[model samples]
Target: MTTSLMHTSQQNQPLISWRWLSLALLVLCIIAFASASTSWLRISPDRQLQISQLQYFLNVGISYCSWLVIAVFANWMRLRIPLFSEKHPKWLLIHCSVAALISLLHILFDTFMLGLLFSFDFNFVSAFAKKVAFWLPVEMVAYLACVVSLSLLEQHKKNLKLPESEQSYTFEQGNQVRVVDRQDIEYIEAYDNYVFVHCANERLMLKQSLSSLAAKLPDEFCRVHRSYLVNLMAVECFESHSDGQAFSRLKSGKCVPVSRRRKMAVKSSLAALHTHIH
Candidate 1:
């Protein structure tokens, strides 16, 4: 390739070799390693005695390096087919198709590279052959996780560009800006970039993630579920099931699920709200 052609090609190349990308990925890997080390009980016991710390780190480093390309591809895929679109069925199909394809490709590529580097026989096919069933689910889960995590980061960036108010929420809808009072909201349900705001008798939509919206809201709002943010003032009662599941029932008779992990927090919040009211 000529000099000008080489320069053009470099400009079009992927971000794998970028210094900032490397540093960010390294930090992510370090955090992952530390978390895994601390949560050893969750790890497979059989693999613990078999793999040395040095060997484990080397393998993790290699996996993460290759995952950088996959991550870039995931981000590209997400932008091409946004998380929330008008055609819900079509959107769901496309995401599933892409995720499956990526998972298979990642499994094959990662297996081949690992075999080439570590295995004596270098038989890539046999390495992940019988384990396709085993590895496919793991890779598919990883791919889905990657896509959702990327969406959060992408949403965070979009939030930074938008202006905020202390007492109300403002969201731009094309040329129109919709501002909703914080006190008027009964609850907020998350749907990717779109949030459905439920009032006493009507529901409205806003173009913002629940996380960003929750951050700006006052203490009256309580996150009862991953997808739900309930106004403490609107809650009629809190229900705790014997099966360990819990729910927040709003005065409007709407029941929002409270995740098992957040049950205690939800109980405490409700008790505090009740005490304050009394």
Candidate 2:
């Protein structure tokens, strides 16, 4: 149930949705119509006579409409492979190839759409293909921007959902409740009914069970064992044994045991942080 909740939270992180896309599509339509209406002001009478009103709309606003389609792919791509990590090289190669392909397809699509606008004959409208150099670079920038925008939006959503004040604990300190920031904690240990939050230069006891506490914290706080949950950011190194047990040594000079059941998960979480693959 906790895993599913985390997965749902991730799904909601992306700001892109049907409502936003619908608004954008409406804006694109308005722009296309506005541009089509003002052709007389922008083009010379002779130039205006050369192309139909439909062709003029396609030439001016097709890229905007194309963006709506690209946004969907951007959301999918960003979710499939993280953009900012060790997978960066692979992401770049894929984006470059995909961007170039999209450029070519977009141009062809424009040319074909223009040709089929007035008649069934699709033998003409090579004019879009003529401006390949101009459109290719634009498409490259636009594609990258689309993906990056989604990534930034997701990060921003996470920040909003977990503001500094929300990412804290008000645990009992003697008789009073003492608030502590999650980032200040290096690691946590399950102390029977309560857990010990090992913070910077001090240890605070939270009157919460480890399992319940684990569900409340961020993904960075990985459960390494039944009794130990080490913050992946604080994990300096990991040592494994042939017998299946392992240990995560924190930067604060404390070694936390990694149970055999959760060993693979702990290793994977650390690897994702680029801490250690071994």
Best by TM-score: 2
- Candidate 1 residue-wise lDDT, 1-278, digit = tens: 00000000111122234467868888978876675555543566665343345345545765686567566666656645555544344866776677667666756765765564456546666767754676566666676677788666544542443233445655555556566665677888988767888877667776667876676565567787899999888888889889988888888788988898777666655654464456
**Each model's Cα RMSD:** 19.2, 10.6
For candidate 1, what is the lDDT? Answer: 0.64
> TM-score of predicted model 2?
0.46
Regions of model 2 farther than 4 Å from truth: 1-18, 30-51, 84-89, 117-128, 149-164, 168-278
Question: Would you list the clashing residue pairs of candidate 1?
Answer: none
Q: In model 1, how large is the Cα lDDT of residue 135? A: 58
Model 2 lDDT per residue over 17-127, tens place: 657776878787888877766874575757536357757777667776666656666665555555744645587778767777877788877877766664555445356
